[model samples]
Target chain A: METLIFDLDAKPLREVNQFLHGDASGLNGKAFVIENPNGAHSIAVGLKSDIHVTVKGHAGYYAAGMNQIAKVTIEGSAGSGVAENMMSGMVHVKGFASNAAGATANGGLLVIDGDAGLRTAIALKGADVVVGGSVGSFSAFMAQAGNFVILGDAGEGLGDSIYEAKIFVRGKVKSLGADCEEKTMNPEDRKILADLLAKSGHAGVNPDSFKQYGSARTLYHFHVDNAGAY
Target chain B: MSEQQPKIPQTKPRFSATFDESTMSEIRRAAATGIYDIRGAGAKRKVPHFDDLLFLGASVSRYPLEGYREKCATDVVLGARFAKKPIHLKTPVTIAGMSFGSLSANAKEALGRGASAAGTSTTTGDGGMTQEERGHSSILVYQYLPSRYGMNPDDLRKADAIEVVIGQGAKPGGGGMLLGQKITKRVAKMRCLPEGIDQRSSCRHPDWTGPDDLEIKIAEIREITDWEKPIYVKIGATRPYFDVALAVKAGADVVVLDGMQGGTAATQEVFIEHVGIPILAAIRPAVQALQDLGMHRKVQLIVSGGIRNGADVAKALALGADAVAIGTAALIALGDNDPHLEEEYQKLGTTAGAYDDWHEGRDPAGITTQDPELMKRLDPVKAGHRLANYLAVMTMEAQVIARACGKSHLHNLEPEDLVALTLEASAMAKVPLAGTNWIPGVTGF
Candidate 1:
């Protein structure tokens, strides 16, 4: 496949995005590289082709947001909301990510090699997130459906008001929010954890060491007893 | 008979003013059910609304145009600020956002068809865009809500305009709640939740928060759609002045302000009635915010909530609103709360025009239910025609008022052409009281 290179210093981010949003039939199965990103916001966002994108440097907020059928890789740190609302494909962050990484994503694989900031995978919908390092508070606050695999420690209020989404943490959890509780890991949970770990390049990690967490099913229907939790 | 006729002092049976019958019943209901009362529709209590304001027709100082001879234009253009293609409508009245889960598919299609036939726009709500609405609506504004349910880039690109919902008028600080009964398989699958689960939509967007962050968020959307589709920011009427100004500051091409009278599918009754200000009190402050920013017409303002007729549209425009949106009224035109369904409503333990239990999914009108049998009762074509007729009547009525006020276009109507019947209305509408040059809030009139 021929590689296409675009320098952010020469061309505007808008031009790059517009080019990426061009006819998917012609642009699919191609490799593109973005140079001198300089933490620009909305880089490679809304991509809908089966193309590969590589960001050489740090990216700003919403990098590759609402992405579909595209593979995006950030070699350096990323700002907030990296790969937010991603529909399908993979987003690999080589370095630390700021707040709300992979927020509200419906379907995707987000691999963050370093620590993630607050509210990572918040309201996550059917996406799989793998974080190699620690995550900040309120991560997966209202996650609906998906799998969140954390190899490191989790901050306060992990999986608050979660629904159906499975959370696997290898390290200690500071606390669990309302309607969230630790659950016994079954064979299916183990398989899902192992698969995500392998795909995110954490193949050496043992799935058995991780503890699973999920919704308690108490807040599914409103009751007076759950008023305090609300 | 003589003994029974002995003198007795007659007294009338009186009830407590504070503890009215309605209030007592609500208290009893709450005691019986531990959960708070949840219902649909807007505030039932009366507030100072459009009826409180009157138009000042031309007589001596101003010249009035001939009714049938002169043309009173009602056309409006929205999102002219940044969008490559702005929306042009024949009439200034549009349909407000109503979710598919809250309303049946037939109802959604009818709204789209009616709005299209009338040459106006209709909006999608929290549950995300449905194919029925998109296929039927000539101009569809897709809502980018907090929940992000069924939100995708493809749909975003397909929309004529995008509205980022910050809050709703019925429950500003609160999130949306679709009870388990309404969470059918389709609704559940679209929302990515389990079937029969009561879905709770978040109050804030998951990705970003605050105005500064919102600016970047809007840019992301613009980049996604290539700046072709207009971007609107919608806010409930809590503090309209601040909210509208902030929405503009956040790079909104249009600002939609929904007042307290806006309807909700399901919300706490207390929150619906108590939270947010009335549209009558909200329009001026929102317009003032736009004027202060020097973006009055550049950034269009769409006001909604209790806008029932052409008079209300005229009043909203006179107070500086570019256009008006209707929700409850549109539902009414589609046959909600029709007296023809009175017998069925009685079986549901409520009377026609008093039925607001939309969350129960037992709608007699078939407009707010997911039941196949109930939904089949509503014919999209017929309901669409009814809505189109209503829209035509409203536009003509507003044209009549505008012609009487010596204005050739509905947008030309100014605050000087209106007066308030009560002090509250005078202060809220910022118009002078009838028979006197006194606006209660302003220093001088």
Candidate 2:
């Protein structure tokens, strides 16, 4: 595979993105390295080809947003909404991530080695997220579909108003929001959890140590009893 | 009869002014059901609207052009500020966004065909873009809403223009509600939700919030589409002056302001009627915001809500709006609430013109239902023809008024050519009262 290198200090981010958005046939199966990111916003966003991208330094908001068929890795801490609305791609953050990581992603795999900020995986639609470290409050709120694996402690209001998405947490959960509750982890749940753990480079972690949580199915329809919950 | 009813003084069985029959009925219904009443369409309550304004035709001081002989241009160009390719329309009237789940696929197709034949644009709504609308519409504006359902970069790139929806006129602070009945198999698949689930769209975008953040969000979108498509920011008519100014600052190529009368698919009836200000009261402040920023015409303004005819279009333009959009009227043009469906409407316990239970998915007109049988009743070609005819009539009517005002183009109409019939209209529209030189709030007057 050919390797392409771009220095953010010398070249504008726009040129890099435009080059990446080139014809899929020529860009696919290639490796691109972004040096000296310096926390710029919207870097490597809207990628649609099967390429690999590595950000050498800290990145800002919406890095790799709405990404498709691409794998992106950030070596340093990322700002808010990293990999937001991603579809069918993989995003890995080697350092801590800010708020709303992987928000509203329809399909993707997001792995965070360090702690994640508030509202992680919110409104997630058919995506898989694995955080090796702890996560902030309101994680997985209103998540529609997919699976989330948390290896460390979860902050308050984990999985609020969650839908069919399955959440596996190894550590203590401070609280659960309305319509969210613990569930019995079956063999299928264990299998999926193990697969996600392996795919996110946590193959040695024990799926049995994690507890599964999901929607209680009470707030699916409007009812007077659930008014307080709303 | 023998004693003239004993000369009894009857009070004429008067109804209370505060609690009218409609109010009492609503209270009774609320007492019966714990949930707030949810319905479709715009505010039913009457407010000061276009009917309160009148055009001042040329007579002595101004010269009037021959209506049939002179050409009164109605063309409009939107998003000329930053877009590589702006939208050009033969008429200033466009179709407002209505979601596919709220309306049938045939209805969406018809709207596209109609708007295309009329040489205008049509917009997609909260449920996201559908192929029916995309394939048929000559100019399609895709909505990037809070829910992000069916939102993708490919579709964003395919759109002629992109509209970022901050809020809707019917329920500004509230999210959208598509009841379980409307979430059919196709609808559920499109939204990526379970079958028959009550889908509530979020009120705010998941990625960003506030005007400062909005600027970055717009930039992100622009980067995604390579700045090829125009970006529009849409807001409900709450604080039009501040909101429009902020949208402009946030790098919008066009600003869409929808007033209280703008229709919704499903929302709390109370929120729809009480939340936002009327379009008649919203246009001037928004236009003033553009003028204050020196962006008038440079950044086009599209106002919607109860814009029924050419007269309303003319009035909106005179008040400084570049164009007008129609939702409920367009639905009507496609045969919603037709008197021909009176029997079916009666079965649904409503009259033809008064039927508004669109959330139930039992539309007799087949325009707002997901039922295959009901949807088949509407022929896209015929409905599209009707809409085209209606649009043509509206364009001609606006041209007539513009010619009568001695203006060669619809955009040439100014506030000086209009007067308010009532004090409320005068203050809201910033126009002088008829037969007097008094504009209620203009201190110089």
Per DockQ, the best of the predicted structures is: 1
Two-chain DockQ for model 2: 0.74
Per-candidate clashes, comma-separated: 1, 0
Give stretches of model 1 more than 4 Å off. Answer: B1-5
lDDT of 2 by residue, B1-445 (tens): 3655466786788899999999999999989987789999999999999999999999999999898799889999998888878889999999999999999999999999999999999999877789999999999999999988878788898899999999978988888989899999999888888889888899988878799999989988888887778899999999999999999999999999999999999999999999999999999999999999999999999999999999999999999999999999999999999999999999999999998999999997889999899999999999999999999999999999999999999999999999999999999999999988999979456
A1-230 in candidate 1: lDDT tens per residue?
88999999999999999999999999999999999999999999999999999999999999999989999999999999999999999999999999999999999899999999999999999999999999999999999999999999999999999999999999999999889999999998999999999999999999999999999999999888889997
- Using TM-score as the measure, the top candidate is 1
How far residue B317's Cα lies from its native spot in candidate 2, in Å, is 1.0
Instruction: Mark the 10 consecutive residues where model 2 chain B has the least summed lDDT.
Output: B1-10
Cα lDDT, model 1, residue B16: 92
- How well does each candidate reproduce the native contacts, as fnat? 0.85, 0.52
DockQ of every candidate structure: 0.88, 0.74
* Residue range with the least summed lDDT across 10 consecutive positions in model 1 chain B: B1-10
- Once fitted onto the true fold, the runs of candidate 2 whose alpha carbons sit more than 4 angstroms away are B1-6
Task: Give lDDT: candidate 1, residue B81.
Answer: 94
The Cα error of candidate 2 at residue A31, in Å, is: 1.3
